[model samples]
Target: MPSIHDILTKAVALHNGGQPERAAALYRDVLAVEPAEPHSLHLLGLQMRRAGCEAEGIALMARSLLLAPTLAPALFNQARALQDSGRLDEAIAHFRRKLEVDPNCGVTSIVLGNEALARGRLDEAERILRRAAALEAGGAFASRLRRALERVTTARGIARDAADPSLPPGLVVRGAFRDSSGYAHKVRQFVRHLVDAGVRVRLVDLNHGDVDNLPDGQIDPLLHTLDRPVRAKAVLSFTTPLVVEAVPNLKTINYTVFEALDIPPLWAAHSRRHDHVVVATDSSRRAWLQAGHPADRVHICPEGVEPLEPGRVAPAAILDGTGRRLADYRVRILNVSDLNSRKNLEGLLRVWLRTTRAEDDAALLLKAGKGDGASGSIRDLLARLTAETGRTLGEAAPLFLVEGKLSDTDMMSLHAAATHYWSMSHGEGWDLPMAQAGAMGLTLLAPDHSAYHAYLNGRVAHMIPSHVTPALDGYRGRDWWTPDEAAAARLLRAVIDDPDGTRLSAREHLLEHFSWRSAAHRLIGLLGGLDAL
Candidate 1:
């Protein structure tokens, strides 16, 4: 007894609320009373498609569109159904027809652009998406259009780069390649490997400020100065999309490293924009997968360390801040970190003071960088530690804070001076310093979890006994490991007592599996495979 309008409204509510069968019956009743009702026909067709009757759904939608020739929703739905069925050409035509009926429909333009991209028609996709962006300006649809447009632009650039003869024919490496960050070191090492392998390579410096300060033979200005299109068979982007917008037509790979248990949702969103992702370790890959990234798209590419020359020894004497030589300590333990709470420096201090005696002539060399935003200053840390331990700074406590920039040679020399290297970090993306120390033949005492598991093991390094605990600092809601102080103290004693055997084992393991040469070979193979695809 209900009016056709009331019936259709109830059917729409039922359909949206997941009562498709009931909705279908109501729609049928509406159609029976008014057979030419376009809305009823369109709603019923969508319900059929949801129920897996693609052919029936398409036929119903076609009939509805015939009755109401300018029904935008019906036209869009028909195009979507065709797309889902893999009939891209037909789907694109129907989408174009839908846009003709509703020229301002941002959704249709986005769909059509995606269809064009999937069909390898980059030019058409870019044109359609740009139009969508203009029409949907200053709204959520505009944001989506912008993202799609970036993808299209990047695709076009890559295609043009591939065809350009002036640029190198091999892979293009783009990142802050000359910076002091761990990512920079990784990029430089990988690029070196590619060059050694006879791969025609090109390096693009994303951090333009660091260009002038780079070491000699580091930056190839000739390649950067070329006036041709930016082309490469593949692009290994170590930076983010915001830094190097697009690399058209190439298999773009994002090399990401996160030093936490959960990858920030924002980072995960950015990562999804790439064709593939390369993480530093299996743990990083797992974190990304847990963050809802597709498993097949994320890969484990563990970082490598530069092997030290044979017979490299610790410096016998290094200058203190006052430029005075202070190398008379019996055993020196070293910790190099960014001085954040996540590094567990407080815990390390507590364990060190409790385990070793001041009379043991043992010195703890704390080579720390400027603190993170949340961390207090080094003077504050020293004051707090002094208050906690009731030991005065200089002669009373064996902790010495070393803060300054050290060149690569100086860093190697510093490593040589240390009797042992230690870290009590809650987590790490790759633990670059620990790997470097191990490669330099320094015995390492660190937590066994996180990225350390990729290279460090019982045979090579002292694996601190630890248990998973709720993360501290800004990393709340996530989990990180806490090393048992008692176990760490014991390992510290073990390393100091048998430094020779421990260092030998650590060095052999690093040289065998974690060398830069091996990592480069693996990267080349992966690039070649992606190119073939």
Candidate 2:
């Protein structure tokens, strides 16, 4: 005869092992033995919900809540089920109830904000989102929230018709690839509007990667690489190298270079770099001049999110092989990044393991790309960590490694499947994925750094204090970049110990700021008006 702990542990093992039905059966058996057991009932309810039995799961969770109203898990589950069933009002009540029990529920804060958004209360939505973002200290969610707040402000500005058509055709921008992408996308929109107003626009991709499905009338690759004459009226480079390197081809009336950060080494290499440089923000411009970039060349321009299309109802690709869908991965934390020295994944793994041990049914998922020579090393390390932790590989909280580049469709599908995204990079050129996840409305854990804070603003991610050097005194891995057995165990515990209510908030954030159409328009403006401005 198995002890109660034995049975419950087995059920959790089955659930984490990708056998939800079997786990649910074990949970049911436990419930049969102890009908009012809140833990058993709650686990069973989650399994049911994961299996797409929403109503049954909701009923079970509600009953569990009745038996143990103080159970934050049950309340949170009930709320999530209600939201899944489109009962937004009821869902809000349950989320509020969960928060009432645990005010520090980061996930609940996001869900509540989403609920407010669903009710069409923009101000309430913004406030609730801001609160959620603010809770993570200086995390990705907070940065995202700041961006969201900016969007709200921008929307208001647009609504009041405060921004006018500015900049002329044939604008050029270059800089660090990521930040440049944001500005380029926005500037592209300005160009498209100009094209509609009968202006010809040319684009340049200093970054080698193809712009995913950019529409026509935008700059094509051939134009930038092949020494095509830039006949624009004005020339602007997000980085100075763009103008300095192509000065001969440029026939613009004025050459303006726009830089958002400290000047790169590439800029200093050019003597007659640019006619003028536009600085997007005052603080950033000041930093550039302080860093020795001439102050006389700087100009100020306000930056915004690349306008995106409103997300629409599309058939979400069920992540079939993973044996779990987005709905199934509820409360699961998804971390996507290259397994390298800069990421500082060990700390996140520690938090995850601790949370999982505290909660019984949690799982930590990692989706990583294979780059450099780190892939095989990471795999071997993970396997060793699992074994040392007394965890069975692919059974007791697995590490799902997805190598290689992914298409946008595949990426978005994975995004849709995640409950939360955790990123702890020491430095960020710009955490695009964090924004994408936030736009998709995923709760994020990000580091408290200037780059993330500057872009995410304050609404979408939870930011934590980061150290200049990772604390590695006790780390067993010889390399700081690799995971130690102890760290792995801690991370595993965090996922299974407690659920984060950030999933709801992530979905809501996406609906507000992430759209393809909007992104396209922004790209047009950035590229089309290079010549005139």
Candidate 3:
């Protein structure tokens, strides 16, 4: 094996040659061999920033700066990382420090001027950019410096996602309203918060079709903002990347998610027409960045969950296969899902077989959505399991799978009928049903991967183990995993054996941490001042 110095030298060469992924692997190798190598630390941090892992990169570079305070590259990279993260004060402070180290650094002056301009420090911006203009008269950054100078007097104060749309000036939310697909559900949920947060949002119903469980006509007149006219300079589109429109003068922010290991390159390419990409989780953000979206233009704003529907009580009863009502079970473990491949229905069924017995008073309530021959698909899954494991679902505990067209009120009733909600999904991108279940006081159990870590902690729910596997199907997210069926089985038996009502007590924490009001206010803050929204 080469020494750490030799490995680092090669890593730096690769890093400079624009092979960050390969260079990053080598830098990690250097860290593994000599954990506190400051050079390796800072270089790896820069690579991380390039990949849009700003927080991680900043932390790594901070550590490197602490270890090697005199490292100029560390300071420069750390300053860039902070700038990429939109921390104007810290970023400007670091840029000033770098300029102090070398007052004649034209690139440093240009960036400092630009940031100062963004902070509305016109005099400071003009002075710095003038110096930069003189120093880099005909250099590579001449045109960029010229642009920065032109914007100095015109620049405004920084907001997360400022109202810089090229059209007149307003925000329009474009998404499908007449559907209840995952995309539609999330869009509707976000609109609820945005409107509640006091935004005068206009709507542009996409009306594209994938799933249409929701009825036509406005579900909530206030939520739809149905009264507002549709004419705006900015659009917050909650559709997939393929439908991204290249409308000039409109600042488009694509609000979407990905459960797969990655997004299609074509989708990623199309999304570039939009101004920014906002997602609900860091994993989703990383996927967009990895698929070639700009690091600084991608961001995370976590989704919130509330009761299934406020003030609407579910129907009184739900019958299981054995004619016993769902309420009859001592412990009703629920999973509201569709027949999607990534849901890992096979893993769920296997766990159900491995753990519970017919004598057990617990039941698994699957409120699966109706799809094309969705009922027959369950039979096919059971048949596959029987051939593979030589055991049937009947030999285990009662499995109650509910597949039907349910109204929102009826769905709330389904949640009311369950004691617990669980999933062994291969992946997720902010699971709405699971979040709703947890919010409704269902003792939640989920695998330790993807968006599950966003809310559920050990104190709140039983978290199962997960192992990284090849991305199922063709998901373009960084990684996916298979939940440990054995571990899930063990948890199920423990919960079944000892029913603890205290598990439901943590539901309040979920509400407190992920309220619609709070999440909406955050989105509002990003768009402009809360009052501006």
Candidate 4:
């Protein structure tokens, strides 16, 4: 005996609460009472879609919209269903019709912009997304609109660059090249390529941490242009996004990466001020997007492998207080990680202990350090993991730990020291060390997840199967990859058994497919796509 209004309200609540059958019954009751109840028809249509009757639902929703022409939600749902059903043109027509009906419909605008992007109309997509962003100013859809515009900007760049294969204007680069971290090396490589591509470059040194490595800074001296009142198009920062200070009136892009699913709060907050976020991998971009950054605003500019320089390569690791080299082992397996949980160094150790024995003619060269907001030593943790596994390192193959500051040449020497490189990382922005090792023609093994997939296949490098697991300490929100220790041990044994089977021309593949020059040009193109930054 409920009123039509009461019945409709109950139907909506039931529908939202996942009691679709009950909601559909109420919707039917409402329609029985008032045969032309548009809301009831609309709700009933949605229930039909949930029941796998997509065509019937679309027809009913159409009928409902015809009866009550201004049912915004009904129109939106019908359009979405049509889009899902592959009626893209019809779906777009419906979205455009929705804007005509509502005028300030941000969702419709977003949809239209996406359709334009799918149709390769980058300019149109940018215009629509911009308009939508302004319309939904400070609302829930603003982030989405901003992200859409970022994509349109990138798409425009790709389209233009493909047509005209010329480099854009040089960018003003600002990043930490003085440090001995992976970040510093990535910036150096990027700068080297940018300068080589005939791009006008200016460098601003940002020494973030430990600058005490021997053979101090000299990053392609051609970047030392002292142009005042910097008329450069954009400022590209290569340090942590958390530390980037935005340039006034210039588009600021913070080039950074993270090795986990969850980004630190401060870093996420700081990146908001920048005009765009450029990450080395999609994994890094996802961390920002998952943390509520605009998707389009964060773009992927993949890091590249540096081609090997044989004469310049130096050997750097010294083992167990003895001047023994990693080269001493017949099968030298190397892993570079720090004290960060996301590095999953413990996983690597577990694999090592389970796979190798005392007389196994193999050694694990752990080039360990402390970086990416990690403090504390790796010794205690490894000892604890070793103890918990009911095994002693003395009974297993040699586990040589190397924690020293090495120069750029020495770092290459460290890679040169190994016969193979392996990582069991939870995630990575772009594991530069892993790439560098592969470039040095070492047998590569990594988890089949995250940034590793960008370069490897079963044929190119051995893959450690992984599954979704709860992210450990520090990295909280999203789930991360956990390599199967047993499977990894098997692969480790398999590769060692047939060392010839591990014969992948990793150096050639990495250098050819992931060129530093190509990465720099794409970066330049991404900036040029933006509407006069």
Candidate whose lDDT is highest? 4
Mind giving the per-residue lDDT tens digits that candidate 1 earns over 1-533?
A: 77898999999999999899999999999998889999999989999988868788988988998899788888888887776554556777888898999999888887777656644477888888888888788977765666666656655666777887876566667666654566666776777777788776656655323132445344443434422444476677786432333454566687877666667554565566678888889888888887888998888777888888756655746666666444677567888887677888878877776666656556777778722332246667767877887765553336666665554555667777776689998888887778888887777887988888889888877888888888866665567788898888887666556555555348888889989899888877776766722
Error (Å) of candidate 3 at residue 214 is 2.0
**What does the lDDT come to for candidate 4?**
0.74
Residue 412 in model 3: lDDT: 67
Error of 2 at 63 (Å): 82
Off by over 4 Å in 4: 1-170, 207-229, 262-269, 309-319, 322-325, 370-378, 531-533
Question: Between which residue pairs do clashes occur in model 1?
Answer: 154-248, 155-248, 155-249, 157-248, 158-248, 159-248, 161-231, 314-416, 314-417
Model 1 — TM-score against the truth? 0.65
Greater-TM-score candidate between 2 and 4: 4
Task: Give candidate 3 misplaced runs (Cα > 4 Å).
Answer: 1-170, 210-213, 223-227, 307-312, 370-372, 476-478, 501-505, 529-533
**Predicted candidate 1, C-alpha RMSD:** 11.9
The segments of candidate 2 whose C-alpha lies over 4 angstroms from its true place after superposition are 1-169, 172-199, 205-230, 234-244, 249-290, 295-327, 350-367, 370-377, 381-396, 455-460, 470-532
Over 305-376, each residue of candidate 2 has an lDDT whose tens digit, in order, gives 322233542324444255754345446556766665456564454344333432234445566653234457
Q: Against the true structure, what is each candidate's TM-score?
A: 0.65, 0.45, 0.65, 0.63
As a whole number from 0 to 100, the lDDT of residue 320 in candidate 3 is 60
Per-residue CA lDDT of model 3 for 439-524, tens digit only, reads 88778888888788778878887889999887644453246778999889888888898887435444787788887667777777
| Least accurate 10 contiguous residues by lDDT in model 4 | 222-231
- Local distance difference test, each candidate: 0.73, 0.52, 0.73, 0.74
